[model samples]
Target: MTAMAAEIKKGRKFDQVLDGAREVFMRDGFEGASVDEIARVAGVSKATLYSYFPDKRLLFSEVARLECNRQAEEAMAEFDLSDPVAVVLHEAANRIVRFFLSDFGQQVYRICVAESYRFPELGQRFYASGPALVRERMSAILQPYIDRGELVIEDMDLAADQFGQLCKSDLFVRRLCGISKETSEAEIKRVVTGVVEMFLARYGA
Candidate 1:
């Protein structure tokens, strides 16, 4: 059955299962988590769990996708796409990098990396939902700049990825390694300013 149709049949129960699964997966890791525990935590029968998510991989993928959506919304909720390009890019980079370097973000990143070896598809799912989503949204917002001759980007896809990676730089890696426990807004603003300057130098009209 289609997901919508399945949702219609299950309603909020499906969400409960997902919530339970997320808790279990995060706590136990993918290989260590058990479907039985998830069902118990969700307060649903095994049949209900199976009906909503036929397999562990599918369930895990959905859980990962939901978490990505949650973080993305939180990070970009107030984002305005119609601002001056420099301001917009700086704000976008700050939010994205800050979210990625946060404590919860590190936990989620480790979980994804740990599970990726066995279920490489989960890595792909996370990328598509997370970074790929940002790249597409940012590119869409910047296309008008190119058309208006405000910027000279020849490949918007590459440009979007470049902008995001520049924000990451050494910050995200150092955070993941526990080399730094925090990133101050002042630091982030400094980093983003340089990134914006570099980008403008390359793409300015």
Candidate 2:
């Protein structure tokens, strides 16, 4: 095989390992997942797994980031930055809430919650990789509104965080506590309307 083919194989193996890692991490949680199982599921040797990710924490960090980024991209695909502030925020809130409150998102959050005591740094890493990444994207998305003078914001990061938290609201807590499955389209719109209204009230020009 040519060097180019070898590089392509290596890249494919890297992605396979990441997919296996995500499955194991989601099913077993970070603390319960094993490197051996990850390697087996990935169809790679322990050496390959270690070559790609020296440690489970490193693998988990990247996995979290990738999953969160994937979800954010999916959500952002539906967003319209050129819309009015309320419309833009409403669309964003609906998509974001659906993703963040989905089963996969809850599982990821549960892993962080479960392993936090033993691997506290993992929580920070997860936050920086996942939530913080989305917040940065949100800041970028909101910039156009600011440029057009549709929004008056002192800090984009803070505004992004604020909007995210507002969208989640008590619904996330209720879901975590097993009292809600408020992720239906109607429920999402109901929740997001308030979030969008509140956010625009604060920042709209």
lDDT of 2 by residue, 67-111 (tens): 888877876787778777777777778777876787767766776
Ten residues in a row with the worst lDDT in model 1? 1-10
Q: Compute the lDDT for candidate 1.
A: 0.77
Residues forming the 10-long window of minimal summed lDDT in candidate 2? 1-10
lDDT of 1 by residue, 76-135 (tens): 666665677788777777777776776546656776787777666666776787678778
The most accurate candidate by TM-score is 2
Pairing residues by index, what is the TM-score of model 1?
0.75
TM-scores across all candidates? 0.75, 0.79
